[model samples]
Target: MAMAVAAGCGGGSDSGDGDTVKIGLLASLSGTYEAVGTEQRKGFELYLDTHDNKLGGQKVELSVGDEGDGPPTAVPAATKLVKKDKVDVLTGIVANGSYKAVLPLVEQAKIPLVSSNGRPEVKNVDRLWHTAFLSDEPGAAIAEHVKEEVDGPVYAIGPDYQGGYDELRGFTETFKKAGGKLANPDGKTKWTPFPKTTNFMPYFADIAKSGAKAVYCFYAGKAAIDFAKQYAQSDVADLPLYTAFVTEGSVLPAQGKAAKGIYSVLNYSADLDNEANRKFVADWSAKHDTPPTTYAMASYDAASVLDKAIAEASKGGKEVTPDTINKAIDGLGKIESPRGSWEFGKTHSPVQKWYLRQVRPDGKQLANVMVQDLATLGD
Candidate 1:
């Protein structure tokens, strides 16, 4: 994997005393989750750019490393950031697998690790908090929507991994609870080779044979792009597709017309009617020339949370140490985010509204438009 380091030195004050707060970010800069990592990095960096790269009136330095696709590479990267770079805190993990690999070292160092994309609720480790959506949250919300709106058999498909299991399980359990049934419970409801498969035609063929009225799916990055395009060209293209993280933001731009009319439940939407989101999209568009994705919003929120915590810690004229930062974050009741106002749950995941969105034309470009305000689902 490749590693890149960028210090936010120019915008913030050059106190020149070596007192810059170092924030280590571990993300997939290459491999399967690179697009996710790129957007996440931009979101975090955008916050710094807008704020003049200062947090709590202190200069901030960001040290970034590619976590690749798994823990083998991430563990060493995290270790280097903590032991060698002596970073004050850690943030930005794209894959849950990477999070699992590097978490032990983070706990040992006792530094606060704020997750931007990693599923935080799944791991019970201390010194870690999630500023991103729980992996199953969007699934649960979609389940609730399906139970209330759709009828007949519902089928599910996802990359065969722990996250895929969690996503599908989250949907199935809630859908059953709300009185929905699977098309084939005992018959291959789950599938695999998550980061391995590129061609999903076989999966789509199986979905067609399942005789389900609706289908729920979860795929991101290149896989998501291919699935949307291929699904649109498939026999079941007209079937109402309900999904979580299956469409929106980065993926939506690529999916384009193929993604039109697809419904999804997620925490952040570019079309959200709120002051914070309006400003976020406007500023993000001005800076990146692209609409912000949920991944970006998550990392952006991570930065916001860190800024608030650091500012709170500075009230006493104290340096923003790990403990002080954590305490400050703990004291915070709610964060006004681009997604909306949300509070960190007991599990460190955000308890926020899950928006039901549909891919549709938004004047010049295709985008995920808010269809309805779905239920809040998180730990």
Candidate 2:
């Protein structure tokens, strides 16, 4: 597949010069997470298209790379972007493992990474910023709400990976703290083997036996489609389902009726009533048949951040270098986004509101309808 490129006005030159801002977008364009990667690319590209392919009042040269599914594929791609392409900034990692794998390259190059997705916990975060929520935040934001809504224990499950571990841990820890219980026989979150566990019947059978009042899980891409479809036909189909990423727009079309009525917690929904979101949704709808996903929204926000940071760094005749851009990002306050207005917190992640959403019919199509405001998180 051909990679998308947004050319700068001037001839191709290194970002060290003032003519262009070189941005490397490393995402899983192939393998299990292809759908997510596609959305990430689309979101970032949409922002560029709207802004005349410019950032900080300068032309942009975007280089896209495939991170695939994990570190083996991601590391090499990252190295090429950082060393060969010499991107001033990097963004768009779909998986947690990929994000962690590329850290050393980012640090060595001293380039800022405005990550569109897959936020992982790390000790050194001086050069990292995420448009996406921390893996744990989605679950933690909704744990108390789930506890209040469900009468009894909730059975938690997710793919076996770093992202899964953080997501489920957030729910379990916060749920227990909120005076809730788990229905798992071992009192632990169940882990399905990543990218290998296509068949979830055994897991559903186990959930049937766990005597849980509801089920909560975190799955995305193809896995989400399989899980949602299988869960709908399972013996425990009547049980309420609460989740984070499973019912998102990227997978909702394939999930179809199976995803209906499922509750999810996320930072963005296409139906949100705000000036920025309305324009965003309208623009997205103009190009596609389906609504925008959180993946796309996050990537779009990454572009917005760079736009402001680059502009800020360029002021007062300051050079728009990566270090200067990084400092500009630190000083950016109250960013207006499709999700709403938010500002980066001390963690260099958006301190934003989480919303309760339900998959419901909008006219003829299904959408993640905004149910209510859940909480303001991301400290």
Candidate 3:
């Protein structure tokens, strides 16, 4: 699902020639998260171009690494960037597994990793800073809306991993905290392990027997499109579908009308109503070949944070260290996020607003439209 490129740190983008800083851009440029990676890469490049790459009179070089499929690729790739390439800051990851895999390597090397994926537990890990919100938490964003509007027994089918669980936990926990219960919040969530299958027949069959009235899920990439298409072909589609971090730009377009009317919790939607949002959507689409997604937006933010940080860090500094650079990023405080406001956590995660979005078709094209704004899923 992911590919890896083991890089050896050699030089920064600047090479100290004329005031340029060298940093690493780690993401699944190939394999599973490729769809996400391509978009993020474009967004990152856009930031560099928009900022003119000379932040605070220094040039920023991005050493790109591909976190292919999962951690196996991500870990070694990160080693290359840190040990071989000699980059100062490392950031961007489309998959949570890659984050889990390369985190220790970055920590061991004392390099900083600012992530694009929202894996909440990452906050507990060392060196793995969260630039993006822990989007996998479903309840934190839309649980209240689900309980108030989705009245009845709710079933869940998640990815069965930290990211999946984080989203399910948020949905079920938030709903339960508001006096509602899913079919089995305490039970194993009904989901397929990401590596367990290429086909989803058995899973759909299992969903048919779960006795659930409505089902909530948080699978992304190909899995999301497949799940929605399969549900449409099975008894499960007869029930409403609710998911978080799934029904968005890349996945929704692929699902076609099979994804129509499904509910999801997210941080940004291509259809968010605001000047910044409108400009972002227009600029992103104009610049890229694909529709805009929350992944693109958050990844763009991650890159923007780095640009701002580098700009500030160079104010009185020369060689950019990850810690000093990260501090600069955090201190930049509230820059104009396309999604509105964004704040960094001490853990490198974000304290930001989330949203409830739904899949809808504008003519033949599919899009994720905002249904609600869910403020940070934390206490």
**Which ranges in model 3 have alpha carbons more than 4 Å from their true place?**
1-18, 122-128, 184-186, 316-319
TM-score of 2: 0.96
By TM-score: ranked, best first = 2, 1, 3
lDDT assessment of candidate 1: 0.79
Residue pairs in collision within model 2? none
Candidate 2 regions with alpha-carbon error over 4 angstroms = 1-18
CA lDDT for candidate 2? 0.88
Q: Would you list the C-alpha lDDT of every candidate in the order shown? A: 0.79, 0.88, 0.68
lDDT string, candidate 3, 1-379, tens digits: 1222222121232243433455677877777567777766776666666665544445555678888888778888888887776777777877767777777777776766777766656445444656567755545677777777766767777776767767777777777788866675455567677755457777767767766678777777777778788888886777888877566657666877888888887777777777877777787777776667767777777777776776676665445656667567657767578877767656556667778777776666767767777666533
Per-candidate TM equals 0.93, 0.96, 0.88
